[model samples]
Target: MTSTDAFNTQGNATAVTDPHTGETRYNRVPQVTWDFWLVKLLAVTVGETAADLINTSLGLGLTNTSLLMSVFLIVALVFQFAQKRYVPVYYWTTVVLVSVVGTLITDNFIDNLGWSFTPVTLSFTAALAATFAVWYMVEKTLSIHSIYTFRREAFYWLAILFTFALGTSAGDQLAEGLGVGFLMSGLMYAAVIAVIAGLFYGGLMNGILAFWLAYIITRPMGASFGDYLSQPVANGGLGLGTIVTSLIFFAAIGATVWYMTRSKDGLEVAQD
Candidate 1:
């Protein structure tokens, strides 16, 4: 914590001493933690309900909802990227906005643009692949822990946008297009995520790949479950309503973020 400490900032990405070794590392993102996953799930669950609330209940429709949420997401991302290091409020706020916009993007492709499930899914998959390919080519690493530079952060967010879009498309394909229903779709994705977790813990897969896979799948899983809880029984759901579901999850997100902000859950040192 001395002025002579090798603290540094790489183009707005803050770097801090490694504590034990005093090595500098740019860690702009939060560490992978339980609360991280918790908030992420809650945020995505809110994404589904919030989208429904705006599109159906509020009568904004798909196109208008998409446009509005996209604008909000851009604003949130502006604040997120402005931070030199990880800040829980800005980071999770951006995530919630991204989740909403990602869902809307896919919904627009289908509901508004008249695209089918197969094309939408495939397009997002291809886009996500290209993003990762270019990111790896330039950065030579795809580890979240190494998101110390602006380009890497940019790549990270772009990849996430694709994941959410891909997940929405695939989830709809499974839940509605294939007549699987939302509850079943959520269960299927949950089973797949469980297998991925097992593989990662067993060392059959590396952390980076496993993390991204789970990240991609969780989007659909959360969305599907959210729909199941919020939609009416006529629509194969519990009829809890979108407002109730959104309120529940957003409350959870607010509490988690408050705790994270007060305690600094992921960061070890007081910097950034």
Candidate 2:
């Protein structure tokens, strides 16, 4: 039931029926394009900040925060897995939930469990590498363009979880441990992402490599940006507060997803 299979089955179905009727199937993945990244960035950014808002702004604490977000992630993932075709609401909900839950995983390990950021960061990096290793071994390909089966979706979500944890730890190390300010940390990560993009666009790097590198880097970059806007001015932030930042980002994401759904503008259905 991987995205790849879902797409093939749905694409081949002539007259698909809804779930209640047990009719036909439909394609999954939207067409890969610039819009995909735009929405992705928005979703990830919300994930970065929303988690903080729930855990800190609402005073839920790490334990409660993780538990709540984990529940939401599980529910969102269920809907995502149930769908035969790509649905923006389900897809983005899962993404946002994963982002929050992933951040909490890293936070729990680092803050609640007394693990150092260095070890947490390295561990998540290794985990991501291992996931990729296994994914490549089984699938022989890591391209997002062909995610038509459930197995690929499993691999994809596992990799995503690692990215969020890695990003959280890395961002914390840079901003708090290394004494780098929020804005500076964001700029630093942004520069690195820019280099990856340049290498990819200039033909110096492969598409998958560039994509993964950028994907990993965006976590810290977005986290840094989130902290910069949400933290108090005394802490070198604009002091917008997590509530305002989270609300604004969520609204923007909702509007964007709504538009994308209606227009099918960012549809990335796999094709021959």
TM-score per model over all chains = 0.88, 0.87
lDDT of each: 0.82, 0.77
Candidate with top TM-score is 1
Error of 1 at 19 (Å): 17
Candidate 2 lDDT for residue 6 = 21
Residue 99, candidate 2: C-alpha displacement in angstroms:
0.8
Candidate 2, residues 173-272, lDDT tens digits: the string is: 8778768798998899889978876776676877667777777788888778887888899999999988888888888889888987898764554432
Query: What stretches of model 2 exceed 4 Å from their correct place?
Result: 1-27
Name the top lDDT candidate. Answer: 1
Model 1 segments beyond 4 Å from truth?
1-26, 268-272
RMSD of 1: 6.4
Candidate 2 global TM-score? 0.87
